[model samples]
Target: MSTTTETLKSQWEALKAENPHMRIRNAAEKLGVSEAELVATSIGEGVTRLRPEFAAILTEVEKLSKVMALTRNDECVHERKGVYLNPDFSSPHAGLFVGEDIDLRIFLSAWDKAYAVVEKGEDRDKKSLQFFGKDGLAIHKIYTTRDSNDAAFDVIVEQFKSDNQSNEETTVAVPLDIDEKPDSEIDVDGFKAAWIDLKDTHEFFGMLRKFGVTRTQALRLAPSEEHAHKIEKDAIVKMLEGAAAQKLPIMCFVGNRGNIQIHTGLVRKTMWHNNWFNVMDPDFNLHLDMDKIAQTWIVRKPTEDGVVTAIEVFNEMGEIIVQFFGKRKPGIPELTEWRELVASL
Candidate 1:
């Protein structure tokens, strides 16, 4: 190893000795390096750098039955439990994982480094495959569960192990700034007209790109109060409570720039502690920073089946923190009870 890397490794070891419970991401920040770089330091010990064949890795992931898929941003963490099935990787820049239990939207272009992590510590022995973006931010992670196929995981890890095992210092790229148009510059009438004529909920992203307007701007330009309206930030807690009371299965989407993790089921437990609104269930947990929620909107979109409504929460920077929707299939319409619950909010 180079002098600089050797010094970094010593520093990291010292930091770990100081606080063994520190997460790797936090440790990387404390050491002024990326998480990928820190994990690379343990290449031969418990980490194996994987070749950047994300699609192939995902295909192998399907064989490791009953794994937990985790995706997160700075403010929210989403975890789902299921097998990675029905993966569609035909697109060069994007991929889709359409499974009944584990649903994901993968942006292939942003995916950069990958590693298979195996940590046998005093307390626990954990195994996982972690993927990172160009900026060294985590895109997605797949962890082995009690019911997972450990043999399959071991085989895939060996299959994709990189030839290069050097632990060299690396630099992370700066994230690009989004060029969002101002609300005033958007054609309010035209945007509203197009929104009203929307055929499917999936077209919402296309509509935003076509008008060159951000999501918050579009919500502000909604034609009528019925179409879009701001709600109290605490409404999220109420919505969750109501859903649980009604036994309503809902879909929650939390994503970063590279991947979106979804949870579709009835949330049975809700807790608020330290300004975090959380769904603490046995298999799924959603931790959302309530203080980061700067705005909440009830948005309505016209679909072939009927008008679909959603509760979208945004942070101060106009980035979506989390979205909630009533669980319904494509051919079926939104639940009347869910619509009533949204209206009550």
Candidate 2:
């Protein structure tokens, strides 16, 4: 068979390999359900029937197919084994999202990697929701409507592993800086000036700390907390300088209304294995657990800032972990559907 044909076969086997006794969502933390479709698929293929309400699945599944293609072979080190999937999902319905890629090690010990995608648009006669996996495997599911958390399609991959049959994965994050922060390696006034001016790349993270902002708390900002708890200059600078020391990769993203997200990169070694801070194989891929890394980034701060903010950090990945963003002003950048579609990891 040709490469594409072989690839399809591999994916089909992978999908079929999933235990029918288990739900479509492998992780208990999975945010959505497939019980209805799961029943449809288990009913011996063609014999399976779809409820009138199930028409939604077809449209969304189509969108999901398109989205999965976007994530193929993208670069992301923080991504856990199961494609760096969620450790504890809060969304009521499960949908594969293509935002910032995560480090699976931060959440689970033995990460099970899988490709994630989701369906989009609404039209039963038009499109359907589709999900795919790593081996170019595609499984189409129908969905009439989606909850806010729906974004992509995904699967738990640990059961296929010889050693990971019974164990669960937990996500953990690693800090970038190895050296302790000196009280002196901080400056909030400078950061404050940066926030107000919005010109020149001024770092305001230091001041955030003065307002009692901390690396520990920075990662917990909610989806709607665009401007959550504004902090003083000193606090912001301290957090920036301190986080930069670890050389952590910032975890920001573009969200609703073209918002730019600015958050700390507590999950170190997520980009390239920091030769200065990590150990790796001959390929130099950091051997650290990715599940742990993702938990570190997510648990640390909620995604803040606007779309421009995430792109800025995306290009700058080094000792200096800086973040400065604003709302959608004319010249300022905002989040975009394409940016999320192109995310790495």
Candidate 3:
């Protein structure tokens, strides 16, 4: 090991010894390094650096049977337990793992480094496969469950293990800054017309790009209150509680720049811890920091079947934190109960 890496390892060990409860991401922030960098410090110590055939590795994850897929951003963490199913890697730019229990939207181009980790717990060893982006931010993670196929996980780890095990730093890239056009410069009439004439909810992203308007900006100019209206931040709590109370199946989407993890089912349990609002279900868990929610909008979009409704939350910086939707598929209209629930809000 180089002198620098050795020094970092010692420092990290010391920090962990000081506070065993500090999460790796928080520790990395405190140590002034990327989370990937800190994980790389333990390269050969129960941590195997994996070759960057990300898509291929994902295809094999289904063999693990039951595992927990985790994806997070600054304000939200999404965890869903199920088998990785129906991987569509046909697109070079992105990928999809579509299933009833586990659904994911993977952006292949954002992935950079990967590692298979085995951490010693009080009773048994915890194993996981973690992927990071070019910016050293986590893109996605797959962890072995109590019922997971450990043998399959080990096989995958060995199959994709990289020859390089050096505890070297991850090459960090600067984040891109895409400037949005000023609201005054945007064609308000054209944008409003397009929004009202939308055919599908999926076209919303394209519409934003076509007009060079930011997501929040578009929400602000959403034609009228019927289309989009801001609600109190704590509306998330009510939404979750209401869905759970009525046995309503809802969809929760949490994502960052690289991946969007989704949970599509009923949320039964919910609670508040400090400022965090959480859904503590058996197969899925959603942790959302309510304090970070700057704006929560009840948005309505036109679809072929009918109008689709969503509750979208955004952070202070105007970046999306999480989105909630009624459980419905293409060609199916939004649930009347869901609309009534939103109306109640």
Candidate 4:
């Protein structure tokens, strides 16, 4: 129970290989175990083994990477272009898509419980899980359930306290900027949508706090804005927290239109992205490991035109973490060019 999957399986396999003629029961005895246990353990080990599909996919991705060599000579990594800032406040690994509301009693609730499990395994430090979905989605979650009187929940709750989850104090209710008004003249819904779009996703609620967008403006801004507005972020979170109890339409940004819409039929889903983020507090563990932590990118073309290579991280659990869309970081003048383009936009 406290051994590596490889170590346990190796023992089992050695016994089986040494005596291929022995009966299954005899093989179990050779491994100093019961036949049922041996059989179940083998099956479990097989499940954890990377699937053939995954192995082949990895091989193919590696092969595709060779194309990076046949390109122009602008290989210098620049400041803005080469900088890969780690956004640790964002959830690690895996992107999930949420179709509808889900019962949180199991996977979602259980995950909040399981995180406290003793770090009983190897250094998953180099490993980042890639969940395939947006920031807030979670699919195929196996959760622990509890009723009103379920005493087990107490034990789980205690574990959280024993762990570091509760050790740190958090504060909310940020001081509003002078520019932030008590109210605005925009239509409540339309303005909210507009505000949400104009806000930044990776930054704190800067647009709302700094730009003085009203709730309606924030909401409107989110759908079409380049970033998230405070109200929009808060609204999305409220839907996620109560998802286990009731299903609600998780608002998704529909292209360039600033319209908000909801999807349904969520059951143990896991497709979400961590869009809103910020760094704060006495200690900055929030930003500890910011970039390229077990992330992957999909291989686009070997090379694209004048651009030699480009890459971005993906959170698909089994898919490659980062994919090169254009040129690799470190450019001659693209950084300045990009800054000017963004500013112009």
Winning model by TM-score: 3
TM-score of 1: 0.94
> For residues 178-280, could you state the per-residue lDDT of candidate 1 as single tens digits?
6677677888788899999999999999999898888888898888988899999888899999998899999999998888888888999899888888888
In candidate 1, which residue pairs get closer than 3 Å at backbone N, Cα or C atoms, i.e. clash? none
lDDT of 2 at 143: 29
TM value for model 3: 0.98
Candidate 2 lDDT over residue span 44-92, tens digit each: 2212222222223322333332221111111122111112123332333
lDDT values for all models:
0.87, 0.27, 0.91, 0.25
Reference-based TM-score of each model: 0.94, 0.22, 0.98, 0.18
Candidate 2: where are CA atoms >4 Å away? 1-113, 116-184, 200-345
Of models 1 and 3, which has the larger lDDT?
Answer: 3
Worst 10 residues of 3 by lDDT: 169-178
Give per-residue lDDT, candidate 4, residue 271: 30
Q: State the lDDT of candidate 3 residue by residue for 1-345, as single tens digits.
A: 788888888999999999988888888889888889888889889999999999999999999999999999889999999999999999876799999988998998888999999999898789999999877778899999999999999999999999999899657775654567788999999999999999999999999989889898999989899999999987778889999999999989999888999999899999988888888989998988877788999999987889999999998888888999999999889889999998999
Ranking by TM-score: 3, 1, 2, 4
What lDDT, from 0 to 1, does candidate 3 have?
0.91
